[model samples]
Target: MKAMLEGLEYAPEDNAAATTAATAETVGYAFSSDHLRALERDGYVVVDDLISQDVARAAAASARAMYDRGVMQNLRQEGRDDDVAVLATSSLPAGDEFAGLRPCVEALLRVPDDLRRVVARVDDDALGADVVSKVRACRAPDRLMLARYGSESCRYVPHLDNDPSDDANDAGSPGLRPSDRVFTLIAYLNPDWDATRGGRFRAYRPGVAADAASPSDFVDIDPILGRVVVFDAAKLLHEVRPSFHDRYAVTVWTRGAELLPA
Candidate 1:
């Protein structure tokens, strides 16, 4: 609950009330108006030590157990050759894998909805007046997921979560929204993760030209335990770098209800 945010940007003095607005009941993650603006401007934010080490370890065990229990399904059939297994939270069952970790998972899932409401009030884009209409409207997000990545130097190539940034998405299924996703939230569960083992998460700034982007244009986030990352899904290109050791993540994708005003 004590969020020592590692990649937080701009806790500006103008909107100082941001800190007070994000009460525990409104947002358990301690997201401020600054965090919301960071998402809009820089495209990402990283929070470290968001949970206790013990809780992170327990979540890691549960994620691994789910994979061992055949609850996690492979992504090979979807066409990519990466070694990844994922399961939706709605379909996730109650068992030893989720005994005490369920509440945390549920809380993590609710962050998007809660955060949107907070932003809609404190932030200018998230702010409101009787004559003005809301620019960013929060919508129902897709189901939360628990993902386990294999340890055999498996890498998921760089790409945006919601490519094309529209409703006409390719993962064409009534239940899936590979295009409407507005924001992506990921929590690392590996309490003892080794940084040298790789699998660092990377996020790219919006490409200004067709081929002008380079390595320096992106930011890399180490997948350490108790670390949570929130980013703009459609705006920033991201990827899971190769991992020599395994990785566990709880991910939630928030849906985009309206186009952000320019």
Candidate 2:
């Protein structure tokens, strides 16, 4: 959506059609019947093992290493900037610490194809077809970030990500007008996390007025390794509980609009 990839300009020169084809060929993952039902009913779904345990572990390790190296800069939320930060993908080059996780990034790029399928299944024929076409026409996001939440003070408040129109993002950047973003995908990287860790992810019902402190009327997801959570970025109000243990996640967004002129 936002051409500014986490504060750095990155426009991949790959052929769009070819990239889409490749994505379709490689992404064998899909939401189960139960998960699909949950998504339609609750606006979110937690799909375990979206990627292999090995891949998730490797990615988490790589991301944590980057965080330790000070590659991530503070994220600028409207009220707080210390809770989160963008993991500078620019600092990661091939054959570096993040090299092992490249396949995970590519897999994430194919997520829109899965979303198109979900749209087809849940929406009416006309609307589903239109949404599918729009998703197909959208370009994959070039920027990937290791969004890290601090163990002590950092906690993401409940908020919607983006809508079709536009809104400011967590990074305190201008929103993506005619917004292409569709879903929010967060792949948990906490290898041996538990409820005691207190970094649980929660998704609320649509139109709820709850914030981080009052999250009783919601679904809580554990930040365990290899768990990928997908949700309607524009519709769901979600937040992360303050963690006792550090949390790491590979966060990316899926687009649903036609590509815009550069």
On lDDT, the leading prediction is 2
Across 1-262, the per-residue lDDT of candidate 2 in tens digits comes to 1332223222332433344466556655455446655665688888885678888888887777666666677756553323333433332334456565655665565666555565556545433343345445544555556777777856777667774333433333222322445667788888889888887887887667674335457878998998989876677878787788888888776654443335
Off by over 4 Å in 2: 1-27, 32-34, 78-92, 117-139, 163-179, 211-216, 260-262
Off by over 4 Å in 1: 1-29, 77-88, 123-136, 140-142, 165-168, 208-213, 256-262
User: What is the alpha-carbon lDDT of model 1 when measured against the actual structure?
Assistant: 0.61
Give all TM-scores, in the order shown: 0.74, 0.75
lDDT tens digits by residue: candidate 1, 168-190: 56566543567756677788887
Judge candidate 2 at residue 63 and give its lDDT.
76
TM-score of 1: 0.74
With a 3 Å backbone cut-off (N, CA, C), the pairs that clash in candidate 2 are 75-85
Name the weakest run of 10 consecutive residues (lDDT summed) in model 2: 1-10
| Clash count (model 2, backbone only) | 1
